[model samples]
Target: MCRSGTAMRLTALTLLALLLTACGAGGGQDAQKGGRKPVFPVQVLEVQGGTVEYAISSTGSVEAFEQVLVTARVRGVIEKVNFREGQEVNPGDILVEIEPQRYRNELEAAQARLDKADASLKDAQAGLKRREDANRQTPGIFSPDEVESWRNRVNSAKADVSQATADVKIAQLNLRDAFATAPMAGIIQSRSVQSGAYVQPGALIATLLRRDPLLLRFTVDEDEARSLKQGQQATFTVTDVDQPLKAVLTHIAASASSRSRMVEVIAEVAPEDRERVRPGTFARIRIVTGSRDNAPAIPQTAVRPTERGFVAFVVENGQARMRLLTLGLRTEDGRVEVREGVKPGEKLVVRGAEALKDGVAVKIDEPVQPQDK
Candidate 1:
């Protein structure tokens, strides 16, 4: 009876083994048909060699090409203020009119004195001619001494006439000085006087400034200024401006500042874009101190800041690969120059790289062309 019971248990155990083997084979088939390795979706950018600009960032201000302080040349009461503060003016435009009555009176008086001097000279000449004629008609009628005295009177009268003529010219000039005119075309930066105000000669009245072809004033460290050159391009932006504007380096200080060790730089804005910014406007400037042709650069977004420095993800054979980067200058736009690591023509994962590991399965879209550097 014991042997029969043992045989039944053995058969039952064999059937259980067959059923387990069949179930395992079916599960393997299901995995082959329906299950696959997980893949991370990502965007890819193919690196290409291009000119990469290295910019030095700094804060700066816009300034007028030329600035002048308008001052009164003649002292008088301000009779009429022809210009308003911040008004636009042209060359020879009337700015202010001082009281002209006194100058006019002076001019008229001078002219009358000149006319009297001319009449006296004419009388002196007539008397001299008559006396000379008497000497010719009768040698003794007028003595030589008397004739010489008449001649002296004429000469003195002539000197008086010359002095009176000079006085008339001076009075005329004073009359013209009573009216102040613009020396050049510009906007009035300030105004200091109004009607009925008395001003002395050389008193500050207004300030004028030329706005177009504006100057961009900035400074750089002495060490970095070595790469700066005349006519090199730079870009700057101000509050409320949507896009960066251009300027050209026009002036570079011959030496560094004694106090700060900073080198002053000046850039001129293009005439066509002058209206977009104003003098004294605060601006952020990017000066292209240096450049490298055919350099590899990547979009700033593609870089991952690690504890060591920075890392970027690249795609290779459907896998994500992280690369340690030795970076160079970052451009004004969101691009970074790669001094080492990652060669041109490599596929860099620009987006969807945050979740990447050094070697992880990834499904990438076709590589995109990087923007021109």
Candidate 2:
């Protein structure tokens, strides 16, 4: 009985030991599976060196190179308005015509008066010659006083002829002024006269504006104005227009405004772009104030705002590392200039930067593509 009892005790002890060992093994497997690290998918881009232009952006209005207010030069009833509203006209193009019948009659009357005066002067001269001949033929028959009087009459008739000639010329000039012509080549902006309307001298007729090689008027701050020079190349983009127009800097104001501390600038658009752009259009100008030939640049999206300053994420040794950067000018195409804390040929994580931090291991799914310079 004692031996059987001892065997039962030994068997029970062996079963308990086996059960404990199995439990320990199961705990070890669970720990091994739970200790696996989580991985995150990330994207990256490369840092590059290229030329970067620093520009000052500004808004401005478009203006014509020339603007003129057309006015009537003579008073008359408007017979016809030759030009329609907003019509393009060349220099010397007839825009308005006043009733010329009255002027013509005046001119004819003046001519008639001139003819009569000329006839009277001829008659007076003939009479003076006759008197002089009589005095010569019959000595003491015709007095010297009578001959002198005839000469005086001829001189008076000559003066009348001269006055009539002057009047005729004045009348002809008035007739020509009855029609108003365009002073310059431009488009009619507004019309103030109509057909059959009575117009007076110096009355408003129309307004004309020249658009070819249009002028863009913009204002810049004092600091920006100081950086600009005449004849510099500039580019302008019209509001809601896709393409940018190239222009040349024409004028820069020497004085600055007291209230705004800004100087005015004028840029001339190319002649070919006149059809696409018009006067009084709003546009934005990008002037290349300065440039660095070899500056490091990165995609603007890669930059992240941090408590300290601007920062970027970089992949180094297959791990994410935070790099603080000093930023420079931003380009029009959404790229930023990097002055410090980055090197050329270094890989930068442009895509997945928002989810990354320092010392995080990452598996690069694809190689980073090189950015364009």
Candidate 3:
């Protein structure tokens, strides 16, 4: 029995040794594999070259190229109103006509007076000639004093004829002015006189606005306004208009507003677009200052606003690198032009960049991305 007991103790010791050996091997493997460092999952985009337009956008309203108040110049009853409130009229188009009878009578009366004065002058000249002929035929038949008196009469008659001629011209002008005409080609904004209404000189007849070269008046930042040229091309989009329009910058204010720090600018609508848009229509304008092709650009979401300016994250060799970017104009398509710092072909962290620290490990989430433009 003592020998069997000793054999059982030896078997138990061998079993314990095998178990310890297995445990030791497993612990060694665990120590060698030491756990992986945490990696931040991020979305990255490849920077690509794109066409970037440097443009400034602003809001404004359309304005008439010229506004004028049409007024009557002669006193008479309004014979006719030839246009509606919004009808377009051309230069020399009659807008209102006064009674022709009264103006015609005045002109005729002035002409009759001129004829009478001319007849008197002719009679005086004939009498003077007779007196001179008698003096020549018979010496001292008529005294020199008599001849001088006749000459004076002729001079006075000549003055009367001259005065009457001026009166006739004045009357003729009044007859012509009886018909009120448009001085320029324009749209009638309002009409104040109607048919059969008695109107005096200088009475309001209508309001006319010139149609050609419609102006787009808008306010822009002073910095942007200062660089604008007189003939710079502009694009316009008006409310309810499906197609965009065009204009040319025509006028810029010499000074900026003190309160708003903005400059007033006027752009002339393109000839083809003038008829499409009207004065007082609200519009948005875009002025392209420059353009760059093959410029490095990235998604706008990749950037973070910083106090100094802006910053973005670039992933290089499995780590995030913070870069200060000199950004250019931001496009409507959600991309920002990188003027400096970042370059094309670099990996830009977009989706999860906000949570990443500089030089931290990042695992790029690869997904099918649409083309960036």
lDDT tens digits, residue span 81-183, model 2: 8888779999899898887889899999999999999999999999988877877888777788888888899999999999999999999988888878898
Worst 10 residues of 2 by lDDT: 364-373
Candidate 1 global lDDT: 0.89
For lDDT, candidate 1 versus 2, the one ahead is 1
Two-way TM-score contest, 2 vs 3, winner: 3
Q: What would you estimate as the lDDT of candidate 2?
A: 0.87
Instruction: Tell me the lDDT of model 2 at 359.
Output: 87
- Estimate TM-scores for all models: 0.69, 0.72, 0.82
lDDT of 1 by residue, 1-373 (tens): 9999999999999999999999999999998989876789988998877899777888999999899888888889999989987788998898988878888999999999999999999999999999999878887798889889989999999999999999999999888888888888999999989899999999988899988669999999987899889998889999978999999999999999999999999999977668888899998998776679999989988899999789999888989998999999887678889999899999989978988898889988665665632
Order of models, best lDDT first? 3, 1, 2
The all-Cα superposition gives candidate 2 an RMSD in Å to the true structure of 6.9
Candidate 2's C-alpha runs over 4 A off are 1-42, 112-169, 239-242, 304-309, 351-373
Candidate 3 residue-wise lDDT, 118-225, digit = tens: 999999999999999998899789899989998998999999999999999999999889889999999999989889999889999999999787999999988998
Q: Tell how far residue 229 is off in model 1, in angstroms.
A: 3.6
